[model samples]
Target chain A: MSRLAAVTGIGQTQYKSARKDVSMAGLVHEAAERAIQDAGIGWDDIDAVIIGKAPDMFEGVLMPELYLADALGACGKPMMRVHTAGSVGGSTAVVAASHVTSGSFDRILTVTFEKQSESNAMWALSIPRPFSMHLNAGAGGHFAPHIREYIRRSGAPAHAGPMVAVKDRKNALKNPLAHLQIPDISLEMVMESPMLWDPVRFLESCPSSDGACALVISNEKLASEGPNKPAWIRGMAMRSETMTCKGRDEVNPLAGSDCAKDVYAQAGIKDPRREVDMAEVYVPFSWYEPMWLENLGFADEGQGWKLTESGETEIGGSIPFNCSGGVLSSNPIGASGMIRFAEAARQVRGTAGEHQVDGAKMAIGHAYGASAQFFAMWAVSSEKP
Target chain B: MRDVAIVNYRQTVPVRDSGPVNELQMLEQVIQGVINDTGVALEDFDFVCSGSCDYLAGAAFAFVEGVEAVGPFPPIKESHVEMDGAWALYEAILKIRTGEADSALVYGFGKSSPGYLRSVMSLQLDPYYLTPLWLDSISAAALQAAQCLNSGTLTEADMAAVVARSRANAKSIAASQLKGDYSVAELLAEPTMVSPLRKHDCAPISDGASAMIVASPEKAKEWCSQPVMVRGIDHRIESSMPTLRDLTRSESTSIAGKAAGIAGVDVQFAELHAPFSHQEILLQRALELDDKVDLNPSGGALAANVMMAAGLDRIGHAASMIQAGRYTCGVAHATSGACLQQNLVAVLEAAQ
Candidate 1:
């Protein structure tokens, strides 16, 4: 209906449990600068800045974008701050894309970061609120019951958790900026790891990371004048619902399905299993790989496990997913969604070194937050929409 | 090119009392007033975005109730900004430009009556460097006022002039709080709230909300008799590090002004969000408006500084002037953080 916008550049930081080396501002700047460089442009070339993050509490700063303006080279330019729970990164990218597609700005710098190590995520998310019982159990703990339900419904074996943990840790080896690197990791190590949430072992869960993700989004005009081939944003969609609602299916969120449907319709994608080349779905917990696979309509209801069980989610498998280690190997919370989007772009560009999906022309990037009710996803491709 | 316009505008009056009603009640009425004024159903708006601070509500996701206020059954497509609703307007505009939605609803709310407004604003400063010093917001504005005075840009008399103009301007505005004419000499005689900034020099603490609905050119005509088209909209930011930025002038405002085509704007009236008297002069200079412009026609934030929503309210007032056939063209401004680190400037006009 309007001029298409595309991702012309992408960059990310080496996610880690603790980035003792750099401050939060410095961590974000590193990613932004690299993204600018990748786009073969300077800060002056950008028209606006749109930054997103999980929460202000994650870094103990209130609307940190105010302070980060100068650091982000946003001085005297329209800058915006977005927050939509954990899916903020994906939402942030879409906001930037809107500016481009709307013909408001020719070039925009979109970034998201979370230095979760600055404070404990479990404590940060569990900050007591009025009229609400403090469950104190982290998001994984909140989802553990749902995960159990999925396990019972699918009748998948318990060891399937370790299978994904080992596969993704191995995928992390390909991403130079990945946070966790268990070079000697094994399925045994994953199986033996302490079960923090039953069926969700400590090691099986994503590591808290201090990192950032950034992208330089531009419209067809800028893309046509780009230094590299553009990742055309075929379609983007975000749908959010109450975290506590009657008939809220934590196991299979309707929002996630609806969001996927909206984006697929725009992208003109009919059969994701056949039309889409690869995927980068948010998987903070290992089981989400299968859960989202089903929710996204890549498989029949409850048959997501079969796709993963048959190795279809691996790098070379049909409809390969999470080729950049996914969120299981790195969880920066705010930046995690953008990382998934960036990894999906990498595969399409044929730039993914260690985990390249051959001839990847189209792919999907997805993220969800807050009891899995909030969902943000995008369909991207090397070919222009 | 497609044009976007503000089809409707509404705000809750800022005063010293809200009695016993909670956020839910306040939002319910404000949202109803706005939706009815716009003549649009909740589902008619293809996009919805808002702005508010969680800390001000003394809880997390305080704006979540605001979404409920919209009665978003079937899940209306929406997003949020942690900044002022003025910025939310900017995001909503982006949606229009992208062709994702033909219309949008942008709103914001804040309640500062429960806490010390100045003391709570210190949270917006740098946690490591500024927070430990406990530099509240009003004092910071006062410091900038003192700097303006020292720079010989204006005197206490000039500061009093701004206060007099703002208060006098509010007299014609409906439900305006601080409206009346007083001489600059009289204002100087008033007691000071903070050094260099008298009680009259600073805006009153207010708790309220504002909502605006915007539509595409085709949809705009269907909704309103006269929609104030968005001619130009821009925002800019300076470093939050107070020590690194110039306190006397808003560098961010000047940048935003230029991007918003301020040079070409033939102004009639403006609704400026000047929390303090001196900052108004600073913003005017940054915007480079000569004697041709009628600035702050509604008394501005100086009359009732309601934090997040006040900025958007300034915008609403300016557009109302144009929509009511009172102004041929106009401008509105909104600011955030200490020392006016972030600034938004919007230009409104009657379509040719």
Candidate 2:
């Protein structure tokens, strides 16, 4: 049997367009130090370090973990770097938990970050390759067609996208570390925003930010001994498929659904909407909120937009989603997924300060990447399984 | 720990430049080869993992395209690492040990021929300090080699001997890129590319891919008649700053070798991934392998270094040697970063 693992501590840097105050190593070290402190442990307590980032081109550093090893206190310890496109953050956490669950290490310091300000993410992602079309501008252009398809299929109102944008930006008010904290954000404001891609406005898109997220994962024994409440990892799963396969569902990817099903099975949840108290799903575009809702089995197919229109995904709603502002508000690209995972852990730990979902016992974190072909999700709970 | 063994391994022949052939095509050949040789369907594996660097490919999410070769139409449990394929194998081991998967398929591919590999590797250095200085990989190794030579730890003759042995060994390996009989004296006579390091001292920039399937004991028995058991595996990293680390020795290798239980096993041979010739001598001492142990029978990385895939190739060669009844037990070592800042070691043994 696999050993139990839990998140004992979490840390996150303030998301911003640029962090001129710190270097790359300093940026990662800040999060790691805070996580180590949050766990009430010293550098010596960590058994290994696992880090993840989107691409080396983003920071112009190939395998930055090799250089940041000293900053993260990974010297003389096993260090691993994980990269699975945009889902890298969540995958890094899953890999770190494996270290504990595999009965290999006791305490692992896992971190994910993105310094998009260091390089233009759009340019880095849109590099022209041989024999490949260059028409798709950036993520916005690549995903805009999928959003249009979702609208065309679901017959959801055009207001559905604006509603999600407003709710998440408003939710950002409660998150001090959120990058874009427009205190007066509203649906009207989002609707009036300039259309960067047809059917997707500037306000509905995620920001390019510099930030890092860290988590201190420990085996069951060490978890119980930690100073803070542990968010027990009930289950975790990752799934991937080819980016462009004939007859693939881009709007509601099977990988996301399968990943959700696998995680829920491990967590022993028959009904996710009733069992999961809250979720922090990856929604770089506001429309993805509803798309992922159905993919995660929280809503019926073609009816996920109805949940947004009904305000059921708000902070006080039955199944609160993105209560920590989510990727829409504070996207550090690579760290966005881990932020979702860490936010879920924070809610279960009752440490989400202002955005805490009251009495949240079980929560799930989700992230997808690479044309929605990669999916990673994990279920966490205050109660141990 | 659960018993796991490498059931099958396949790799493309290393080439200086695989012109017109992309990474996906190279990977497909090896992945298909492994499947055909083992008679195992793709869906039979419980997990799939890969290792590659976007920097080497000069595009973001390059590994994503490599995934197409796997034809994951039904979606599959998969993950990836930015490290060497040896680390991918490490993750696969963890997955099996965690009881999450009974078997896994791991692969690594890199097309280093597309770019100026020497300068491209500088991007892996500290961006603020080292990269700005443009300290390419060969110069970095030369710095380490200079330190080794200055310390009298090993003479230039020792490095030449390693190059000679590697070249002679590559003659029998079909995938090897550099192969020809050459005496140590002839190699030493060649002009140095970088001071204290001859042109032959460096591993060539080769493009290639490798794939391997590992399974639990029960599955191993059902699949292969002589599965090479993976007795122990461990990897560790040291300080990344070249100045902070001892350039003359591979401390990380020593630590990982000890952790992998290398000392307890009567290792009959060893496959060491030493990109620089002098590194081979340093690693031999660090691993404490005497002359009795056969070293780099597949020419190691000196003959054909495929960047991310070379490390995994070492493990594959080690396991293959045991499977061929060439040796009952062996150790495989892989290194990464400058001056061997990180290292992985594994012990493979044939069924007793």
Candidate 3:
């Protein structure tokens, strides 16, 4: 194929339950401007703009890209809108990178945003079609049973869930843009919080937020001229499988494993645990940090919760994951996965402000969607692959 | 850019209420027919991409089951878009451009019969300002049509003529649900289903699927001697608010077509997925394809608009004409979201 692509700029918004100050288009523009600033160029330098978000139903704006183009300085450029469920953010980034990799565009701007406050996701997701069953349970209900299965399979301590919630929230305090910041959060606070779904307490669930993420991907020569040093895009891969069947492994999903394997292979790493310095995973619920940890092959199956209990996922740990608070602390649904990816690049670039893990060389970014059946992951490094 | 050309194209007979075959079955039959017509094995293709929506199937990731159509024993490099197959075709070409694959197979299918197609479609609008009100797709389009009529952007006579011409064209095609020749006065005699948009003015909820094969320039020469060359292609979107955009014309289509080299073509035929007759006029104005272009020779979406796939079929229909040696150059158009929120235009030519 082509040589490779690198990420020269990354930006994320101050995620919140409702960004009432800015409109949906405004939220995305804010992030795009930040990324442009970070890249040390005006919007005129951008060759093409690629955008994505979850379903059009989420924000009540069908193909919001149409409304967002001018705001993001994409008036005369070819802007491609992509929709691929939750991993849309990562998919959008890949599509932008593909244009660069295909020798079409030299520098591409990719952005994904979700203004969840614009509509009720619980109700929007439950728009009863003609023949489908109506369960207004939303995301928590859709994924809780799977958490129960992970608990049963792992046979981990009950405190593992609370432990993860406290740690990730505390990490959020270090991240100014993270959506949630619980002042007095602790293991006890998490344990005492009202359970929204069994095993998923109120403190554990991600807040529906209004936020956006943006990235500027460029060729090697172009990346060298960025405002801050760019993180070389080592590898990117995406995988999918049927959402349901006779035997679906929610805890150790095949799609997650397959996606990880492909991404790791592309990055030329046989042992992800040893080769990767850190990771930023899509964890809307606290428990998924461990579940996806195992699913991502960072640890053996059923032992991922042990990584959480051991405090290994926090900063300074051997494999520090979600140093930028992750989706658990700031989830704007469609933009969450891409935020993970941009955060990973930040860590590698040594530009992660307060949340930067020390001297991190290579980092992994992961995102999953649709009952954990779709997975997209990539590796970024201080050194080019 | 990768030199991807349309090598094979096929579609099922559009039916108002097709029986027995589910979405997957329809996809398989049409995709298999495409492969058979091409004289190529299904596994010979290096990549497969599909386009479809979950809302139409009453579930999520509706295109997953379509893998059975290709019989994926080899674990193909595949992807699906929650859009029309034309976009999927665009992505597949990108893959080929990146040197990731050679030839690719693409398809899209939807059965709107199971659901309140129009109501489900309303979910595509901005949920906060519009969907909470539960505005069905027909009423929304009807409102736009009424607004168009009131402003003298389109007349009732003009709308009727579009219906009459489409039905007249549909009679010659075997795979059409609504077909008949009628005068403008006869259509005006019918009662209104939605004000300003009679039943004849809107397209039926068609149950159909379509498939197309694309190969790089080298592979296309090996597969088909007379490949329909995709000369230029591009898509664009306008604003989301209905009032903000001009309902009478599609600025987005005009921008995309001009960007895609549509203005450079000596257009011989065209297929614009209007759905509503009035939309045809708007699309025509946007593409600037006047009397010189023979639009919707395949009866167009006015006869059968199968949501996501219908738009892709527009591109395929135009390209098929080029392959049949009927046109030197042609234009195809596909629209998405409400009132043509997004538009894709492809310029195709038959190389001499």
lDDT by residue for model 3 (A1-385), tens: 4557899988788999999999877888999999988888889999888888887667655446656766787754667777667877777777778778877678989999998888787876665543334545887888899999888888988898778788888899999998888878888888898999998999988889899999999987798766678888888877666555556576677767877887788888888888899999988888898898888888998889888989888998888988888888998988988998899999999988898999998999888876676677889999965
Q: Top TM-score: which candidate number?
A: 2
Tens digits of per-residue lDDT for model 2, B110-155: 9998899999989889899899999999999999999999999999
DockQ of each: 0.58, 0.85, 0.32
> What would the per-residue lDDT of candidate 2 be over residues A34-96, giving only the tens digit for each residue?
888999999999999999999889888999999999999998899999999999989999998
Ranking by lDDT: 2, 1, 3
Per residue, candidate 1 scores C-alpha lDDT tens digits across B1-352 of: 4678988888887776565655656667777887888777888988888888877766545566566677654655788889999999998987887777899988888887877777778877877778778899888988888888888978999889999999998898875678898998898898888898899988888888888989987898898888888888889888888778888878889888888887787877777888889989898888878787888988899887777888899999988888878888988999998888899999888866
Q: Backbone clashes in each candidate structure, one number apiece?
A: 3, 0, 2
Better of 2 and 3 by DockQ: 2
Worst 10 residues of 2 chain B by lDDT: B57-66
lDDT of 1 by residue, A61-98 (tens): 77888878877998778889998777888889888888
* lDDT, residue A220, candidate 1: 89
